[model samples]
Target: MRPKDEGACSGDGMAGRIITVAQQKGGSGKTTLTANLAIALRRKGFTVAVLDTDPQGSLGRWFMERLQGVGEDGGLEFSTSSAWGASYEGEKLKRRFDVVLIDTPPKIESDLRPALRVADLVLVPVASSQVDLWATEGVLDLAAREKRPVMIVLNRTRPNTRLGAEVAAGAAALGVDVARAQLAHRVSYAESLGRGGAVAEGPAGPGRDEITALADEIMAQAGIEGAATIR
Candidate 1:
């Protein structure tokens, strides 16, 4: 059986939400987004953990760097997993963290399916084009099969561009919940990880605000408003 959707914060009446970040196309900034989102939520005074299912090991390496004092300390919990082991590890993480962020590989495979099956919400990051939007169909199909909620994030969006808005509208037309906040194409996003930390650990910038705002919107969607917190 598929896992049901969990709460956004403490009051939603569940242990925590399992968010799987997936994009079939590589270099969708999945790892960067995941690390930054995990840190942003941690700053909100919530206990957060990450399940790195990507074989690239980018998330795992980032966490190792974080422990070495390369970035601001998140006190974030982390675990690595095989594609086949994702479901088991995800359940364990839900019991321990307020939120568990799963960074899936760039392809839809047996490993990716289990993670999708267990997610409360699956975040699909797209750029400002139909190509990006098209890339998400496979993931959307998987989420649909599992009857999971989905949120589309427009990453690397150019300011004052009609393309971003158009893409979002097209997505909404197709029944995807597009995020109100978007990530800008900023150097801070990529360079922060070079220092072995998330954008939240860097100097205050739009990158930081965007991620925080996205986190807030996501929690609200999960009905986690008010004094809610995950253990």
Candidate 2:
């Protein structure tokens, strides 16, 4: 853990890609995805920061917990914002890191729109259920309205089930890009977060492999060669 001042600051003087993680429904593991994804990207040696715009502030809380040296954050930068301040803060954060990931509120309303407007890519996580798959529709429409590219991430996937393959097929049929990497439902994810560390930062496991693939795929989707060359 480091001082609060060690987090991202203003005037970075370069613009990096902005990614917004959003979903219309809750229990999609949105905050969990944000926290772990930051760790995965940092593993790639990129300067990553989070612009946590969710009112629940779970991401902020996790960052605070990590600051107490409870887990392995790798000194990743994190910032928080009110409901509508995501756009402004996201822009500022991009200047300081290779990527700025925005975790939006769990709704498809006003608060989410600004973040979408500034997003280079909007990642929508869908859990393993028809209901979870249905939840992405409104969010997809919202991202379309903002002219932002959207990718569907199958989160908390039960590997043996057909639900994930089905959801990916459905989204593909509709011309939406579904990430090839599926973050499986794992006890390690919950345990690591509780310990203030990402699964990627914990010992080697299925959880770590999934997020490592996710980081690679997301960076490629953003046309990023690597975080080391962002400047």
Task: Tell me the TM-score of each prediction against the true structure.
Answer: 0.86, 0.89
lDDT of 2 by residue, 1-231 (tens): 111123455343546788999998999999999989988877666667888888788888888888876544433778888868888998887766777889888875787899999999999998888787787888988888998998889899877767767866776765688899999988898887876788887776778889989988898887666644111
Overall lDDT per candidate, in order of appearance: 0.78, 0.80
Stretches of candidate 2 off by over 4 Å are 1-13, 70-75, 227-231
Model 1, total clashes: 1
Give candidate 2's whole-model lDDT.
0.80
Tell me, by lDDT, which candidate is best. Answer: 2
TM-score of 2: 0.89
Candidate 2: which pairs clash? none
Q: What is the C-alpha RMSD of each candidate to the true structure, in Å?
A: 5.1, 4.3
Model 1, position 32, has a per-residue lDDT of 87
RMSD of 1: 5.1
